[model samples]
Target: MKDHVMRLAVGSSARGWRVAIACPRDVYPQDSDSSRYLLEAGVKLIPLSLPGRISPHGDLMAWAGLIRILGRLRPRLVHTHGFKASMVGRMAAATFGVSSGYRPVTICTVHNSIAGQFGSGSRAWNLAKLVEKVLARSTDGVIAVSRALEREYLELSHPSAMLVTCIPNGIALERFISVPPGGGGGVRLPSDVEPPGDAGPPGDVEPPGNAKPPGDLGSPGVLKPGRGPVVGTVARLIPQKGVDVLLRAFPLVREAFPGAELVVAGDGPMRSQLQALAGHLGIGARVAFTGHRNDIPALLRTFDVFVLASLSEGMPVSVIEAMASRVPVVATCTGGIPEVVEDGVSGLLVAPSDPGQLARALIWILSHRDEASRLAQNAFEKVTSRFSIDRMVEDTCLFYQEVFRRKAKQAACES
Candidate 1:
């Protein structure tokens, strides 16, 4: 979410718009290094004491605070992202006390559908869906990250569906494109491998430039002098990611290609359990767990193939990022994944939670070098053409302007 906000801020500012960011204090501290990055990037940071989890009293206070801020700013537009921010921020804007101006063009970007985050059977999911339905009617405009998500919102029978537009998430493509494969850019120092304990918490790493790969496509095993083909996945060790299924599928992949190595990046609560499972499968020695590392671009370059064994996703940025790095991908055909990864066209897609099919896909990519290269090239072209940050910013600003234009006309009519 922060990535999305930051990209918009930077892109808007580049186009000569004054952009400011308002975020929960707990999540984004005022003195943090990340806040400093925002400040340096020409974004004014506003911090609020917003609660992390659901708290009726805390949310009420936050809503009051937002109303006060909106009243003072009295801006022509206000946009909120995510479920909590959309719920509170839109209501606050609707009720903000302003005597002499037209109502602001308040908009919300729904990043995920209620059913995607929580299962359909949960009471909380049903309640959230209801709230979203009501809120949708009050907002001036809506942005769903994918067409599938837009369909989900329309199914709720919200009148605001007419105001909704689908804009797939975008990333900084140039950096990924410029990244050097493997060890060509420079020799990575030992210290760079493991940071000092004093370093701040992990975040996205900048792309390493012009790195070279280990071996040529014609080389045997498609490996470097002493290394095997690395199959990697960057995801949180959570059930939603289906990391367990990936782990289960690893051994099967190993059976076909003994020299293959599995690397899991990112960390979460299931870390320990996953480690135990790997050890039980007796493939722990071949599998590497990189707790959390920011240098994803460099890591992706090192991989022969990337896998996303997620049970569900909303157009996963990780898969897009991997494709941007020109790494062949094997992702599950769930949610908006199929929208991004076209099976046998740009990349391979397998059934969700099916380890056998996933293993087969991985094995096929590793074995068929020419086909993998073709898929990677196609995937790169697709991402560069469709999911660049510049395109997203242009689309978003157009939406804001269209909404504001309609709003100004409505006010003129009343007068």
Candidate 2:
């Protein structure tokens, strides 16, 4: 939610823009990029890990905790993200307004529709939507990640467009920028690997950026932890992400390229089903599930090809991270993917829910080594030139500045 928006805006701002994020403790545990960026930027983080996701842990004392917290953290601006956090956080901000912190502006980001719950006809789905309708009216503003999502959110009542802005998520460049080509490091960059350090310093290049420092250089990056043409996919193993579709396609990929291995990261309810599908396809032995990793850059370094076979998305940061790492991506052409990858230029795209086409694209990239390498190099260059973290931060920073400036001017005119 807002964390995704803030992540894109982190370096965009001058680094001092204070934020009190309301997330579950698990959402930003030590290794996630969200945690890394928050730590790097030195922003004050407020995690809401009440016992039941965002619900209270004991004695139904959530109300007391909210009052105590909002009173203490009188932040300049409070932004609510996701389901639990947004619900609790919005109410907290409203309470602060009536009793204290009237100066703080409260905003919420609707990453998904409250109506879009996990299952059909589920009571939680209806409850979540009801809660969201209340929050939208109370929050100062709303940030929507995609037009598709915006329409869903506005189906009910919300403030005017002036109060709700469409701000898509962006990948942070610093988190993905390659190291220059070597000011003096001796480790050689991997032939197919791209990471934050692989690009090397722009000057006298003695080593590759992806190469570990002198001490760590003895170990290779690309071939590390295992061998074979490694494929990395970062998405929750759920229906929407199309991991099942990827599993069905993997058998065909193995038929074409027997030396390949797959690394599936992240977890969800459908994970077991997808894993079973792998066994049914007879490729289960070749697949490894890392279960929600924080070492994505290192994982990217090991992968030769990156794939995002999702049924839908709104500009995924993981795909951008793959591009930044100079990995050739084979993502499905759906939702906001076309907005990210240019076919035959940055990476290849295929239709969603189509296993054969997805397999064909993967096989094509795997067989044409030279073509894959060229595309990977071009993708890296594109990230460095256009999608750099610095640029995202700059763009997002300008967006926030403009919004806040307009906010101030409107207040003045009204007064």
Candidate 3:
């Protein structure tokens, strides 16, 4: 998407900046708009693919690759994503020593602190905590999408106390508003003479072999030949995400709206457990677990009402995408959700981990179509106005500038 944005949009051109994106693997193990963005913007992409993703084995592999990259590209700044990347990336910059006078500022955005957030009072969780404590000191910048997460990082004693900025993830505003719910996204004649190539996108991936096919997946909200209102949640099926809470709540929603179906997107360690839980809950027949796919937009379109029941989060990308798809959302108030949803206005906000409350909200959205539409419209307006990719990129770029300025000042004092 980054490539497409730069090639087609203003201010994102290759001439505007010299940039580089470093990831363990090529940013696109499979081609994506992100890879395209790097190519078109002419940013040098240095893939630092590591060997294992397991434990010490993965750790050593990642560290070696990252150090090698630092020795080569050695850009003025580095922004790392995910815990593994940040640890290795930040350590490499720090190894260069303070004598460099901050020539290369390191930044990390915590996508999901799974090991920290998950695991119930266990030694494994504690080790993750310890790792975070050590890694926090090496990086120059730490960005958290939620105030909750920023607080978590601060409590962990991150070195840059004041550098912790809360920047929520954003969606492309015009895209959300223009693409109506369920692809009722009214057909507007594009200037293109031929239909956009299929190789292009809206297609990111195919479902894993173990998963069901798209149309066959029996999503209730999908307006297909045989479909009903499917209250869906797209997220990792981890304990912290509270997928179980949603599962428990489904029985109630099903009782109220018997025809209602439940669709779950994304896959994780808890996939089998969730399927088993659905069976246990007696709504197994109504449940569809379409593992992760690039066709999020289509899935979002299928949701007559969307639900996010995470116990903790950082303003999820799913909610924003749903609002863009014009699907009314019923989410729990945990992370940065309150920032996006305006209670009874934009969407309904219920307490986290309460299945009853979540079920009630879902039922309300279903029973009242007019209200849902109005709420969807409100959500659409809110997301389009406040949460946008342009805003996100601009804020991020400004941070880079600040880091650059700080580097220059530190250099002059040293000289």
Candidate 4:
């Protein structure tokens, strides 16, 4: 969610929009690095005491806060991302519509499918669908990050699906593209495309794999010569990411690539458990838990293969970054992954939560260097051509204009 907002905010600012961000105060503290970054980027932050869960009092407080902010800003449009923000932002826009008889355009970007996060049969998931159906009337337009996510939403029979515009997530291409073949190592993009000096490294990744530490995996420069392959993934240590499956699969991968190293990036609640599982499998030494790091481009360059063993995703930005870095990808076939990775073409895809298949894919990528290189080249070309920050921003700007045009047409018809 932060990535989308950061990219859009930066891109939108470049396009001459006076963009101000209103976010839950608790979620994004005023003095936090992220908040400071946005402020420095000229995207003003309006922190509100928004509630995390469904509470009548909390909801009332949040809605009132939004109303106050909107009333003061008198912005022409209110853009929201994710489920909660969309709900609150849409409600506030509706309230303004009722009182002033002029609703500011409300645009929403749904990051994931309702069913993907919560199971299809879950009550919360079904209730969310119902709510989306009800609130979508207030939304001027909806943006789905991928076609698969759009289809998943439409399957719920929500009319909002008709209103959705598909736009795949894009990264600041020059960030990854500028890095040297081996790592960042002082390499730089053209002056025009370079990001601010303080923007820092993006989050780097992948799921867990097993092996006991021969001595201390944390120790630097401890690896033997010809450590074989280094497979990396940049993902939160969470169930949805399927790190556990990666851990289970590592043992089999070791059988083929004996000195293979698994680099798991990102940190989450499941870190301790995942670590224990790795130690239990005697592959802890082989697995490196990088926690959360900013040197993702550098990490990608070090990887022999990049893997994303996710159970669900809505066009993962990490995958795109890996592709942009020209690393061969071995990702699980789930959500919008198939849309991005063409099996045996751009990259290899395996079934979600299948350890055996994942191991095989990783092994193939490591063993067949030529095939992997071809696949990586194809992926790099595909992402560079189709998924650049400029392209995403242009599409977004066009969508916003389309929504305004549609609204104007409706007003004329009513009159």
Lowest lDDT block of 10, candidate 2: 196-205
**Which lDDT tens digits does candidate 4 get at residues 208-240?**
232111231121122223345677889988789
lDDT of 4: 0.79
lDDT by candidate, in order shown: 0.77, 0.64, 0.67, 0.79
lDDT of 2 by residue, 112-219 (tens): 544444443578766666777776666667766666666666765555634666665556556555533211222122222532212111122222111111222222
For all predicted structures, in order, the TM-scores are 0.86, 0.73, 0.80, 0.86
Q: Please provide, for model 1 over 1-415, each residue's C-alpha lDDT reduced to its tens digit, 9 standing for 90 to 100.
A: 7778888888887887777777776555677776776777787877766676778999999898887777667777789998888888887877773433446778888777678677876988888878877777668788888878878877864664237788899998987898877723222322234332221112221111121222333322344434556788999887889999999998877776666678888899999999999999987777788887767877788788999998877768899999999999999988888899888778888888888888877776776667678889999999999999999999999888888787778779999
lDDT for each residue of candidate 3 in 1-415, tens digit (9 for 90 to 100): 2222232233333237666666545445447676665576576666766543545677676666766666666666777766666667677677654534443677787766444365546886676677777866666677776677777777666565336687677765555455544663221111112232111112122321121222432222212333346687888777777999999999877776556678888789999999999998887777878776666776677677889998877668788889888898988887677788878778888888899888877766666566577778888888877778777667777777776677668669999
Summing lDDT over every window of 10 consecutive residues in candidate 3, give the lowest-scoring window: 196-205
Worst 10 residues of 4 by lDDT: 196-205
Candidate closer to the true structure by lDDT (higher is better), 1 or 3? 1
Cα RMSDs of all predictions?
7.8, 10.0, 10.4, 9.4
Q: Please rank every candidate by TM-score, starting with the best.
A: 4, 1, 3, 2
Q: Lowest-scoring 10 consecutive residues by lDDT in candidate 1?
A: 199-208
| Regions more than 4 Å wrong, model 3 | 1-15, 30-34, 51-54, 98-103, 113-130, 158-162, 184-227, 411-415
